[model samples]
Target chain A: MINKLRMGAAGAVFAAALAGTPAFAADNADATATAEILESIDVTLVSGTSLDFGAMVVTGAGTVSLDASTGNLDCSDADIVCSGATDIAEFSVDTASDGRTLQINLPSSVNLLRAGGTAGNAADELVLDGFNSDAAYDAVNDEYTLVYDASGTNEFAVAGDLTFDGSEGPGVYNGTFNVSVEYN
Target chain B: MIRLAASRLSCFLACLAAAGTFGIALPVSAQGDLLVAPTRVILDGRRGTEVILSNIGSEEATYRIGIELRRMTSEGQLVEVSREEANELEQAAMRMVRYAPRRITLPPGQPQAVRLSARPAVELPDGEYRVHMSFRAIPKPQPVEEQAEQAQGIKIKLIPIYGVTIPVIIRHGRLQATVALSDPGIVTGEKQKWFQLTMQREGESSTYGEIRVMKRGNSEPVYMVRGVAIYPEVGERRVTLPLSSEQAAALKGPVRIEYREMPEAGGALIAALETAIG
Candidate 1:
């Protein structure tokens, strides 16, 4: 049954193409080419961007935080020495439909562990939590909402607070976190 | 030309930092760019439908598709519930929904369809069942350069994985719901005034639509919010709509707040209330 439908669709396209030619034998053809268009929703991480908390030296352990809305870093703790450039994670959402409501979900927390260290080793990990975003928060929904603009594009930034308990190993740490978006 | 050179210098510095510390060149854009059509799905009958998943990024990507259970909180949050913790209805819903090609790899600008159908048991009760379908991009392991072993400084590489989930709903039999709007008031916050109300829902199904507030005699709505939903799991949902100073002033007298179905759903009125706001 599927093969027959495929043949019929191919035949319809061929007949339509032939009918467009000046030398076609038939004056007209009633071939049908049905198309089902689906609404498009695209989510992309902005190029050349990452949630960088910058390089910091920890003495007695404190918090280094970046504000998602303002791109401001708060490293005022006396024990932490902060340096280098920091960035908030950014994403762009585009949809074919205008004014569509979307939910942006960010991980509540993520752990950055020392490279080459065993998983689940607390000594080698730094905890990052208190994830915040620039998206409008819906108190009713307890989630963030990103409404597509007139052009169907919405961009938002995400930031979080990194904390070290003063016992974390000093090696290079690597980790991954997830962000999700869904239609509301 | 100067701007181009500046960007190049930054890029070089970034590469130098990576080499001097981690000894690996971080990906410029490692996360997958994904697109999914018809973010929400409804299966009211036996006919199956296909969801199109497209890879819009520059590199090929793999996506793992799976069905998960989520329950709606009174506050309107969808919290993930493990299979062991799901209720009988949720378990049944998960068992009935079927989809093929649990995973797929797509090249840039290419799209693949994941077909889904629901098969309710013979004795299944008449109600609405819902599950969330998640499409997550599996992260690829970065290749470690030889110099990675020689680098001394401790560096951190944070990879952000991107994913999306759409609610899939199946209505087995007759389902209906009624909504009511109540407790209309004004809340003055630090930055702005907010219009607050509670939506009470009853019956077996869920209600989703838009809320519009208008002055007693005006044709235009003074305040409007779209894509509001009250799932069956919750009896009432408190909604706080942000209002401009002018809108707050205009809403001082008698106003009408109406909750209607989404425009695509024919814009039928679900609930309405008339009250004065101060």
Candidate 2:
């Protein structure tokens, strides 16, 4: 009888120990997940030109957004300030027929706004507009005001020269837009 | 032209600063690089473009930069492109052109290809894309064993190759969203600065989506925001949170934007965007 009583007491203690494990594990997982979530960022598009999908934008959300869902980013030589072509977050054009291409190389200087809600974690759209070349620097109000414009669509004239009557030749050409984001 | 692969405007201005014809030498480390000033091109359904290429080498070096499009696996490892299969590619990516310097011998203080070119296509979406270039010395065939022995003593033949590859980007599109800024207008006082965030997306054929952005305790955002989408759109959208007057006043030097991403294309999750806001 004494031995039975000892076994019963031990069983009760063991059951209590088991009962605490789930709560402990859940708390640990929740804490870890919260920490991870705190240190994350999300990126998405807003407005401008047309979204032809020349490049891909990644986000913290759960879904993939396609360029077709977006519009075109429009800016040209008329806007002396570097716009449209220069502020591209990312791209993949190797070079043009004439050996000219553009690229973005920043040594960690700026930050981009991101989406934090659960609505479109799937994806966010981007619009590259509000390009006014008159401003040499990125305008405080505009995100890409300082970006350079080098796309053929702007001042590039990226194909064979067209002639109304006599002009000819110099058909193939290349172009690129370069700009720097220097932070003080 | 000291370094052709560098910025055209910068180089031109530097030349003028040195009194037009007087010469300006570049740092030794800046030599033999095929630098594409603005490493990306954004087209508004347009075609034909140009950029600049230069030999940033301190000494006379030859440049035969090879440009091609390779496939990126889900793991993010680049699959070397085979020239034979280059015949098939996206239509917009067809009209590719680069400085075909059969051999560009740039002097210690000279630049070349003052103007480069590009030809854009009109039928594509707005998102991010990638392309690579190899700027190393072309490998020469090795001599036969007997040919080597026949040469003086031990025919010592060595070819030192040098190259630096760069990724080119193309962003095109329009985006509009209601940004929820922590502060309406980012204001700073007492030698302080704050950070705001934005996002851009290029087009498809891309394989990345999903990212995360966050900061330490302070004013915790109710939801988590993502910095990069495997393929974000090709436009800019604002997502800012105002820094309280107190935080701005106590600010030291820089605000940080630390982010991480898990590319659907495959590979370990890595830091996608890390910028400073001051």
For this target, which candidate reaches the highest DockQ against the unseen true structure?
1
Write model 2 residue lDDT over A1-184, tens digit each, in one string.
Answer: 0001000110111000111122223322322111000010001111121212122222121211122112233212231111222121221121211112111121111111112212222121221222222211122432221112223221111001100111111111111122221100
Question: How high is the TM-score of chain B in model 2?
Answer: 0.45
Overall lDDT per candidate, in order of appearance: 0.72, 0.28
TM-score of each: 0.81, 0.32
Candidate 1 chain B — worst ten consecutive residues by lDDT sum? B1-10
Q: Candidate 1 DockQ score?
A: 0.22
Q: After superposition, how far is residue B200 of candidate 1 from its true place, in Å?
A: 1.1
| List of clashing residue pairs for candidate 1 | A172-B154, A172-B155
List residue ranges in candidate 1 displaced over 4 A: A1-37, A96-98, A138-142, A151-153, B1-30, B146-154, B188-193, B241-253
Model 2: CA > 4 A from native: A1-184, B1-36, B39-52, B86-92, B96-103, B121-130, B137-156, B170-215, B218-278
lDDT of 2 by residue, B1-278 (tens): 11022233443334322321242221223223333322333333334333333443334556665555654322122334555665334224435333345456655334433223344446655533344544443333334442223311111121223343434444445532221112212444232333344443333423222223323333332222321222222233343322335544444233333333332224344333433334
Q: Which 10 successive residues of model 1 chain A have the least lDDT summed?
A: A1-10
